[model samples]
Target: MTERQILLVKNSWSYVIVKSEEAGQLFYHRLFEIAPELKSLFKSEPKGQSRKLINMVTLMVSKLQKLDEIQGEIKSLATRHHKYGVDPAYYRIVGAAFLWTLQQGLKDKWNEELEEAWVDMYAVISNAMIKNQQAVAA
Candidate 1:
């Protein structure tokens, strides 16, 4: 991603981060709406799960420019995700829900540039997480 794109995501994220709780709630609500079958994969309470989601996203967004630095962590997260029932195909749906949630939160601040920037960032992160996984260990 270009430095301009990275700045766009970070700058827009700053506006919405203040209401992260609501953002997390919206994300899960929208996610379940789109992929109800995936809801069963979650083992924690909704509130706690939301906190975990937001916290991880916050960490990732902060490190967007140096995603390689967090590659190990991202891959480990992928392993946990596999154990939690996330399939390789599900990243697309997750990205959709994530982008939609960001739009809902950012409102007027949401634009094509920010959306594209986020798409780029998510692609990089998801690729890192998925590149090493062939199958979930039994």
Candidate 2:
């Protein structure tokens, strides 16, 4: 991603962190609404799960420019997710939910440029996770 794209994601995320709890609730609500089956994959209480979601997102957004530095961590996350029965196809479902949540959270701030940057970032992250999943399956 370009420096501008990275900045856009980081700046937008700053607002998201202000209402982190609500954002996490919105994300899970959207995710379950779109893919109810995914709810089964999460075993923790909603409150704890929400915190985990926010923390994970925080890490990703903060490391946007230095994703390579977290490649091993991302891979480890993917491996754990695979054990939780997370299918590769679920990445798209999660991405859609995430984008929707961001749009709702950002309201008027959501725009084509921001959306494009987020979509690209999601793809990059998902690709890394999927690669790790595939390696584990092999």
Candidate 3:
């Protein structure tokens, strides 16, 4: 991510942190709505799962500039997700749910530039996860 993109993401995420719980609920609600079958992949209770989701997003956004530093951790996450039978295709669905949740959460602050930055960030993260998953399978 470019410095400007990182700034946009970080600034927007601050708003999200204020209402993290609702944002997480909205994310999962949208995710299940988009792909109900994915519900089976999650074993945790709703509240716990929501917390995990928000925590993961927070961690990723916080480390956006130093993503390389966390590649190992990201790969481990992908490996665990692969064990859960998470398909690479599901990443797009999750991205859509995430963007929608952010838009809903950010309200007036949502814009093309911010959307693009988030999309780019998601692409980077998802590609890393998918690549790691494929490597593990290989």
What do the candidate models score in CA lDDT, each in turn?
0.86, 0.93, 0.93
**What TM-score goes with each of the models?**
0.94, 0.97, 0.97
lDDT of 3: 0.93
* Candidate 2 deviant stretches above 4 angstroms: none
- Compared with the true structure, the alpha-carbon lDDT of candidate 2 equals 0.93
lDDT of 1: 0.86
Tens digit of per-residue lDDT, candidate 3, span 77-136: 999998999999999999999999999999999999999999999999999999999888
Query: Cα-based RMSD of the predictions, in order?
Result: 1.6, 0.8, 0.7
Q: Taking the candidates one at a time, how many backbone clashes does each contain?
A: 0, 0, 0
* Tens-digit lDDT track of model 1 for 1-138: 999998888888887789988998999999999999989999899889989988888888899889878877787888898777678788899999999999999999898888999999889888776774544354
Whose lDDT is higher: candidate 1's or candidate 2's?
2
Give one digit per residue, the lDDT tens place, for model 2 in 1-77.
89999999999999989999999999999999989999999999887999998898789999998998898889999
Worst 10 residues of 1 by lDDT: 129-138
